[model samples]
Target: MSAEEIRRAAAERIEEAEDVRDELCAALHGAGVVLPSLRVEPAAYADERPRPLVELGRCNLRTARLIAEALRRGGAGA
Candidate 1:
C-alpha cells in the first residue's frame, strides 16, 4: 500500500484504539474501578506500525484492589 494509505490505516487504528480505551474507562467507572492513567499508548501508533494498543497504565494499590474485586465479582469484565 501507499504511504498515504498506510498513514490513514494507522490513524484509523489509533482512533479505534482510543474508542476502546474510552469504552473501557466508562465501563470501569460503572464498576467503581478507576484507572487514572488509562489511555491509548502513543508509541503503538507512532511509526504507523500494525496494531494499536490501549494502555491501562499504573493505578494505585486501592484502585488495583478495586479492579481485582470487580473482576472477581464478575462486574464489568463479565
Candidate 2:
C-alpha cells in the first residue's frame, strides 16, 4: 500500500481500537475497577521512512491485558 493508504488504514484501525477501549473502560468503571487514563498518540520516529503509530498509553499490565482481550473479542486484534 502507498503511504497515504497505509495512514488511512491505520487511522481507521486506531479509531476502532479506541472505541473498544472506551467500552472496556466503561464496563470496568461500572464494575468498580478504576483504570488509568488511556490515550492514543502518534508514535512516529525520525527514521529513514516514518509511518504512523497508534500507541495506547497509561495502561498498567492488567489493563493492557484486559484491553487486548477486549480488542480480540471485538475483532480488532489477532
Candidate 3:
C-alpha cells in the first residue's frame, strides 16, 4: 500500500535471503568447504518484486575441488 510498507516487505525479503545464504554457508562449512564469495545478489533488490537471490560467486581451484568432493561424498546433503 504505502511506500513504507513496500520498503518493509523488501527488507524482510532481503533478510530471508541472507538467512538462506547463512544456512548454506553453515552446511558447506560442515562439509569442510567454504565459499569465500558467497553472498546475496545485489541485483535482486532492483527487481519489481524484490525477491532476493543468493550468489555463490567464484572460488579458487582448491575450493572448487573441495566442493566437488563434498558433493560427491554427501550427495543430496551437499
Candidate 4:
C-alpha cells in the first residue's frame, strides 16, 4: 500500500483499538478490576506450514473488532 494508505489504516486502527480498550477498562472498573496488558503466546510453527516464518502485516479497524471479540470470549467483558 502507499504511504498515505498505510497511515490512514494505522490511524483507524489506533482509534478503534483505543475506543475498545477504553470500554473494556470501564467495564472492568465497574467489576472492581483493572484491565491489564495483552499477552499473546507465539503461534506454533511447523515445517509443513505454507506461509513463511516472517510475513508482512497490516493493521486496521478490523483488528480492533477482533481484539474486542477475543476479550469477550475470554470472559473479560464484564
Candidate 5:
C-alpha cells in the first residue's frame, strides 16, 4: 500500500482506541513501518504541561510525516 494509504489506515485504527499512541505504533508496525525505539513519559511539570512527553530515538522523515498525518486524521494532533 502507498504511504498515504498506510497513514489513513493507521489513523483509523488509532481513532478506534481510547488511547492512541500505542495503538498507532502497533498499526504502523502491522503495516511494515518500523518505528524507532521510544518511551512515553509523564510530563515532568504536569501542572505546566498540557500533554505527555514522548522521546523518539530516531525516525525517518517520511515515517514522521505519516505519523503526524495519522494523528491529525485521528483528531490527535502530533
Candidate 6:
C-alpha cells in the first residue's frame, strides 16, 4: 500500500489501544520519526504464536516510518 495509506492505518491502530502506544511509536519509526527502541509485547494469548506487527491488520511504527521515508523519496507505492 501507499505511504499515506500506511500512515493512516498506523494512526488508526494507535488510536485503538492505549497499550499500543509503543506500537504507534514503532509505526512512527517506520515513518522516520526516530526514537529509542520501542517495546512491544506480543498481543497474543497463551499457546499461540505472537503475530508480527504487520499481521496486526495494520502497519506498525517501523513500517510507517519506512513508508513515510519512501513517500518523501517518491517511493510511496513501494
Candidate 5 — worst ten consecutive residues by lDDT sum?
Answer: 42-51
Go through the candidates in order and give each one's C-alpha lDDT.
Answer: 0.86, 0.58, 0.89, 0.47, 0.58, 0.52
Write down the RMSD of candidate 4 (Cα, Å).
Answer: 13.1
Top-lDDT candidate index: 3
Could you tell me the TM-score of candidate 3? 0.82
Model 1 agreement with the true structure over 1-78: per-residue lDDT tens digits: 999998888888888998999999998999899888898887876666658778899988999999898888885565
lDDT of 4 by residue, 1-78 (tens): 887776666556555555665675566556444335431112412222222122214435655565566667667556
Q: Cα deviation of 51 in candidate 1 (Å)?
A: 2.3
TM-score, structure 1 vs. true: 0.85
What is residue 66's positional error in candidate 3, in angstroms? 1.0
Alpha carbon lDDT at 67, candidate 6: 60
Candidate order (lDDT):
3, 1, 2, 5, 6, 4
Instruction: Give candidate 4 misplaced runs (Cα > 4 Å).
Output: 36-78
Top of the candidates by TM-score: 1
TM-score (C-alpha, index-matched) for candidate 6: 0.25
The estimated TM-scores of all candidates read 0.85, 0.47, 0.82, 0.42, 0.35, 0.25
- Cα-lDDT of candidate 3: 0.89
Of candidate 6, the 10-residue stretch with the lowest lDDT total is 45-54
Candidate 5 local lDDT, residue 16: 42
Off by over 4 Å in 2: 38-78
Q: Model 4: how far is 38 from its true place, Å?
A: 7.4
lDDT tens digits by residue: candidate 2, 18-55:
67777866876665454665444444332223343434
Residue 16: error of model 1 in Å?
Answer: 0.9
